[model samples]
Target: MADIESEQAAAAAGSGALVLFSGGQDSSTCLAWALERFGTVETLGFDYGQRHRVELECRDALRQGLTDLNAGWAARLGPDHTVNLAALGEISNTALTRDVAIAMSEGGLPNTFVPGRNLIFLTFAATLAYRRGLKHIVAGMCETDYSGYPDCRDDTIKALQVALNLGMDRRFVLHTPLMWIDKAETWALTARLGGEPLVALIREQSHSCYLGDRSHHHEWGFGCGTCPACQLRAEGYRRFVAAAV
Candidate 1:
């Protein structure tokens, strides 16, 4: 398999894109989608000193898969561009950071919610794109199923786009392929872009669990299957698989 950098490099040929990849199902799917669409894709993964290093491991695996998918593409994609932006770490109190109890709060931000994560990530991605002279940055943020997150909202992304363009003195396109799609639709999209084998690889290899539990059933990826993310993923998978049959 191609490494993240390699796969992205394959995608990054003449028409390039920068993707905010997290080695999770949604982001992996987006990565694959970027490869198919842009031909030249660059990946940016952040290391905020999360307690779980498995995310990075999976990221590496995804990158490798990308490389294996198209070695020539990987070669063209260029090196993996990753950053250890732990500055955003201190601002987040989510379970993704500290050892505090992980629970989904009611009617407000969930404990799994990291403060300004997407904003920070997209900002970094945009900055990198600006430096590389690429104007397109892709993320997998969803509004249909995850409308609770303020950052994932379409208004928020559009605002951020405006801010980034103004701040950088350049225009950039923020691509959110999954923004309007629910999980089931997202799965269908992945299957369409990457094939059934790739979608299966995503379902089995990607990590979506906030708890970092790797023993969950096959329905969801790694992590406790009872969490909101896992439940939603499982539901989406069920819907997709049933529909396919």
Candidate 2:
């Protein structure tokens, strides 16, 4: 994490960063991290026609919430970008895209894993950053505690950065604040970057459950707390809280 911290300090000290905001706990926290570190920060989201459009919809309310939390600081985060990836569902088939039970895929990976989703996401993020002359692109992808998505791995992102830079002939560094941290650390990150208000807001507002069930409430949020995503989030939150105590 020393390298990541150094890069983060540099990004914060330099121009600005563009974050891949998903309106979930991880991404929301990452947004705060970017805002705290970078001189200027922007956000982007993907409308990939997932099973639940709640995450996409939450992006706006989330941004407004950020502004509401710290108006003076939030305004510099820049305008939000929502790319139309509706056709992406045509190529990818998973519980995230279609109506399938939350189970495992053919290779024993989570059923919710949308093949190449991150690839497409980062590619678009890099392109957007490149055009905007932004050097850093931040994401909330985590490997320590996650849904078993391969694309979220650190190596995969590093490779993609290299490939994207080579293909576009531009230098765009991808920052993953939650790459090595678990969900618990993610919650801590939110607190560290945005304080208690942000931690509370994310716990109550961010939509992370794959089932899209917001009825059952917990310390971790409105997740069903059964889906793979929910389970990870709940466990992480529990651990984070326990450790803090």
Candidate 3:
């Protein structure tokens, strides 16, 4: 059968991957995948002045569990770590970083969209990758389940990849493991890579709650079930668990 177990282990030994981790469900899953696929796994998280401090909390919790970096990956590879792009956070006007009241929109970018957030994050990541000599930067962004966030789209990532290589002297590669996969498939991928218990930990321990509410459904991470992010998560988990049985 080629031993799927052995195959996964081999994948873990072959490469070095740096994840632009956000400590959310998607990014955490990507971190787990990187752990299993790369020999040297380092994570970079942003401490941008975002409205959701819960995101920071989740990042810390995942780092404690993963222990990938020496003392909290955020402190190491964050904006304060390699680059000094602190002004981006200060300048952003999006609801994610600002105190803007988010009103849901049916089309176009939502209030949660942080202008040029991913661009800045990825650009910084590419710089870090250049000095470290790492070839790949992994992210957990998804167009399938995300609100009309323009940066989460495939075209944006592809464009950024080209820009990174042209702007920086390094030939860097950007890998979005969850780009094409829907939320249910993401759950399955994490479960297959890290086992059911680990997957459950990701679902329960990680915070996806945009509203910062911990008392949501136990199926997924803590997010207000009413938010767009939470709605997708709840629906995805329901479909995932149902399909598993």
Candidate 4:
């Protein structure tokens, strides 16, 4: 394939975008989408000392795939910048970073909700983009099918965008690709943007399981199927598969 879509995206964007990539299903899809839509895409990751660090391990392969898809990416793409936020581990007591149990209490947010994660992440991405003179930041945050994270809401992101712009005195637009769609629609979008091959690649390679155990595989990545992340991903994959059939 010519990867014409990526070229068109680059032209349309007129420059590059900074993507908050986590090497998970959502962020990987966003990375591929950004490469296809923006002139170039810079990937930024965080190492907040999550117990399941396999997510970060996948970043390199995903970035390499972008180059394979479009030779131009070898130049246009920015090196993956992963920051170590070990301090976050010291401050938060979530299931992601701690040995604590993942639980949801009667409509309340789950124990997996890392406090202020997206806010801090996007802020870091914006600061990095500002330094590089790029004005667009891409996040794969979704309101639907979200894991009850307050920070993932549209209002929170929009508010942060304004705050970052005001704080930095620069115009920055945060783009959320999977904001309104649920997990099933996310799969549909991956198929649309990168075709069946990309979809398959994500299914087999991307890591979304909170448990971080790639040892046991499922149709929807390497999730344990008991955790919230696994449950949601599996359900979404089921919906997408049924619809395809």
Best by lDDT: 4
| Residue 169, candidate 1: C-alpha displacement in angstroms | 0.9
- lDDT (CA) for every model shown? 0.80, 0.85, 0.74, 0.86
* Tens-digit per-residue lDDT, 79-196, candidate 1: 4688887877777777778887767677567777777888999998988898887868999999998728788999999999999999989879899989999999999998887687
lDDT by residue for model 2 over 1-245, one digit each (tens)? 99998996775667868999988888888888877777788899998888766887778878888888886557667978889998898788888888888777678898888889999999999888888888889998878987678999999999999999899998888989888887887888888877889988888888888877878899888878788888888888899889898
TM-score per prediction, in order, is 0.87, 0.92, 0.83, 0.92
lDDT of 3 by residue, 126-243 (tens): 8887877677789988888778678889899999999889988677779899998898999999788767766767887787766667765665767777777788888888889999
| Clash counts for all predictions | 23, 1, 1, 3
lDDT of 1 at 154: 90
Off by over 4 Å in 4: 1-11, 72-75, 105-107
Candidate 3, position 16, lDDT: 60
Candidate 3 residue runs with Cα over 4 Å from true position = 1-14, 67-86, 105-107, 215-217
> What's the lDDT for candidate 1?
0.80
Worst 10 residues of 1 by lDDT: 70-79
Model 2 scores worst on lDDT over the 10 consecutive residues at 70-79
Error of 4 at 1 (Å): 28
| Cα-lDDT of candidate 3 | 0.74
